[model samples]
Target: MALMTTRPWKHPKTGIYYLRRAVPADLLARVGKREEKISLGTKDPVRAKGLHASALLELEQRWANLRCGAASLSEREAHELAAPLSAWWFDQHRDEPSQQTFWRTDLGDGLWPRRPPGWSLRPAVGAALIEEAADSSVHARCAMEDWCSEQADALLKRRGLVVDETDRRKLARAVAAVMQRASLALHAAMRGEAVDVGQTLVVRPAMPTSAMATPPAEMAQNSLLPISLTALVEAWWREAERTGKAASTHEAYAHAFRLLVAFLGHDNAHRVTKHDIVRFKDHRLASRKRNGDLVSATTVKNSDLAALKAVFGWALDNGRIIENPALGVTVAKAAKVKLREREFTAEEARTLLRAASDLTPGRELPQTYAAKHWIPWVLAFTGARVGEIAQLRRQDLRRETVAGYPEGVWVLRITPEAGTVKTKQAREVPLHPQLVELGFPAFVEGGRGERLFIVPDVKGQIAGPLQGVKNRLSEFARHHVIDPGVSPNHSWRHRFRTVATEAGVSGNVIDALCGWSAKSVGERYGSVSLKARTDAIMRLPRIEV
Candidate 1:
């Protein structure tokens, strides 16, 4: 039998080519055009099958290439291509494969392919493409956001809503929101109309130009005007101090100035009239210090009136004012009274001494009392001022024997370096026995570098001199409800003088021991020997607790 050879043939109905071998009538009928010749370049079935497979592979590769080309056209590029191509004039210069391709069509000679007329992008389409590009890239997005923020700030400035940089930021955010909504609407409109998708909406920014821009101008030139009564007084005070006025005189001037400042505010200085000064004097007479009893009208007229006169005089000299307000002011004259010195009674002195000895530390009591409870007793015994006690040093203690009596006494030597004395004269006071027993040596020895009294350990470490001792004693008096007027620290001095006099010690000897000037015919009578002074102080009756 003869072998049948197969050949490749194209099917007319399906428009596909296939290998034909062992040809069946029904299959041949399916591909209608029967007279069509099959060509595989051979009459062999095996060779025709290999050729058909190679053709299929080539078709697959062509399909893949078309798909890749379509994918490479980005959303931006596609929008550009679909719109009128003239809008892409800017994009044609951009460094992109799509841009390059478009550029070649526009700029290249016949060497490069020319884009067909219908293929170019329109202006709206190009704008849409740019907007799309802005959204896709970080740099473009930032630029767009910045533009929106700046536009919002300008609007706020124009509307006078920009109070500060903070307000500007808030306005920018608000503008951004508005711009975003407008952009979305524009985008939607363009999409519906099949116009450019990349086009972004941009609104013009407003600028501000008004008087509010430079800040409100001064309503009046009153800022430079002098308004201070205090300033006027201070000007006078400076001149007085410059001329070396006495401190007491200057202090009186200050007190008057304070009263004037209180009556008339600092701003009303130039406007004050003579009537105002008179009214202030009247007010002072009606005022009282601690009690309901008013200040004497005579005192107000005399002392306070004199102080006000000085202030007005200074003000007149310095050109602060044209006239002295206190010039014609009259004060009531005070009657002078003669009074005799009264010493503490024996019973009162004994009660005070007993009170001093019985003193004990309590809660809320001063640290001075807590640390040195015997200080008040020592003061009662010695009649020493707080300053004298604080200024005592270890070397100032002198031990001696007089008439078979041994004595341990600390002498208070007041030099100008030690500070101002009450009488401004140097004198020595004897230390009492109670002071020695209360560890006076520890304080004197430890504080040899400075004053004797160590600052009590208090909150805030407000360490200082004899001021602390005085303050603590005042607190003690108040806590114990002791009549402050009768039993003050100075009262202790009076008690000492009275007790020594009562003990039959001579006034001259007592004066020497207590640092008092003797009231006698001559200065020679006041001067007692150191031995006699010590003897007199020792002979004073010691009341044991």
Candidate 2:
């Protein structure tokens, strides 16, 4: 038969009893009726008495279950409780060896699987235990350990807690001591604020940290930068201000700098020597236009070299570099003087004028078709730049009467306020009666205030002045095939200048009508009476639309 027993012991200091268990080895080894016990390890008399009573109650219940044959030994229960039983046995024999040595021996043997019943008496458990174990000194020590040196100094200064160097030194030492005591990882702990991390404290590289950082010097020297290119461009902008460039010039410089920075990242700027500029020039020559056609090397060389001169000039002035690298680079000369000038022949102008009057089949009439149709005719007859024509307002036109003239003539006063003229001076251009017959009256009558031309319809129903005019002219030029080389807009102006020069118009008189000033003659000859110039412009023959 297997049997079970309980032993009681009590603590001398606390008078607490702990139950100790013991089981017969023969019964434990057997399959049936295996025995187990609970041990109370203390030896105090009062606790021992309580332990004895508790053991009696437990034994009574076990005996009743055994007698009824409802309780039987389980192999798993025996195996599971073996370690706890071994541990209890060792505690009972602890006096034979040092307590630490005995505990180590039991642990090494894999004993103590089950928790001790007296574990509930630990100081971390009950409210009374916590109260009795609380250490004010350690709590203060932990509080002091949380302070960061820099943050503590800032806080003390902000709160007026530091009165002098002594106070600062005292706080600094306190912060250092706290940091040392806390044993924090310096980098990790410094990442956050006093209470939590904020964006201002987030560490990032001082250099270009984006994909759009300045590009290679060659690429940047060739292309425009996107608007999003930030840090380096912004730094350059600040530097530009320090250099005292004119506000408008600085603004233009900033715009160009941003474009360059976005194309080439900031890191490449340092490497951009004079040699790099030469390579960049070659690259631009090889590059294609937005239209997918390869740009002429001469055209690329001319435009980009001029722009580079401006950029390097600004860079030198601002101390971005010590010298202009673009010095001696030259572009191929324009071949226009050798090439015959292409102008609209009288027959071609008539054909274009007729084409402009009627709408092409299957296409809606252009919004500025009326203005664009007649505007080109006027340019061909009067020799005005497209910009000068576009800038004309209804109020600028006047009816002039000269003493020798039989009738009043319609004239346009080209104002300097409109925009830059060829001569950088204002002049009057006469409107031919033939232009009036071709629907100039209706065009002028339809507009309000200073606006002369109607806005043209564009894709997405958007309308504007010059864009619409160019679009319509491009369409007409494509339809007629009138000198495939001649752009509809440029051909008209060329025709007027060619005709006036061939007709023996004085260059100065022609220049006055065209709002051009002779640089040699200077501004003294640039300004002329609006009426006299208007009369000179009227003598030119007009082609009917």
Count of backbone clashes for each model? 16, 23
Residue 36 lDDT (model 2): 32
Q: Candidate 1 lDDT, tens digit per residue, 1-545?
A: 22233435644433333433332343333222222122223334565466655533433343344333322223343222222222222222222222122112211122213355864566577786577566534343443445435444333322223144544444444444443433333334434533343453222111101111110011011122323455555656676756655444555566666777776764444455668777888888778854255877776776777777876655543334434567667765667552433334555555555565576756643445532354555556566665555444446555544454454455545532454344446666555555566666555566424434444344522224345566666555444434534544566677777788877888777666556655666855436665666666667666654
TM-score: model 1 vs. ground truth: 0.41
Please identify model 2 stretches exceeding 4 Å from their true place.
1-280, 287-293, 320-328, 334-339, 360-371, 405-407, 448-450, 453-475, 478-487, 502-504, 522-528
State the local distance difference test value for candidate 2: 0.48
What TM-score would candidate 2 get against the native? 0.47
Worst 10-residue lDDT window, candidate 1: 207-216
Superpose all Cα atoms of candidate 2 onto the true structure and report the RMSD in Å to 1 decimal.
34.5
TM-score of each: 0.41, 0.47
Q: Which residue window of length 10 is worst by lDDT in model 2? A: 205-214
lDDT of each: 0.47, 0.48
Encode model 2's per-residue lDDT on 1-545: one tens digit a residue. 53333445443433444333343353233212233322333345666566566555654444443344322223342222122222222222223222221112112222112457987776657784576359554343332322223333333322223234444444444433322322222222334323122222222221111111122221222222211223334444565546643333444444444444444564334334456566666666676855355767655554556556666543433323323556656656666543446677777777777766675434544445555566666676677776567656677777778555668777777775554354546667778777777767567766664555444235522124444555565566656754556656777767877778776676777766766556684655435665666556666776654
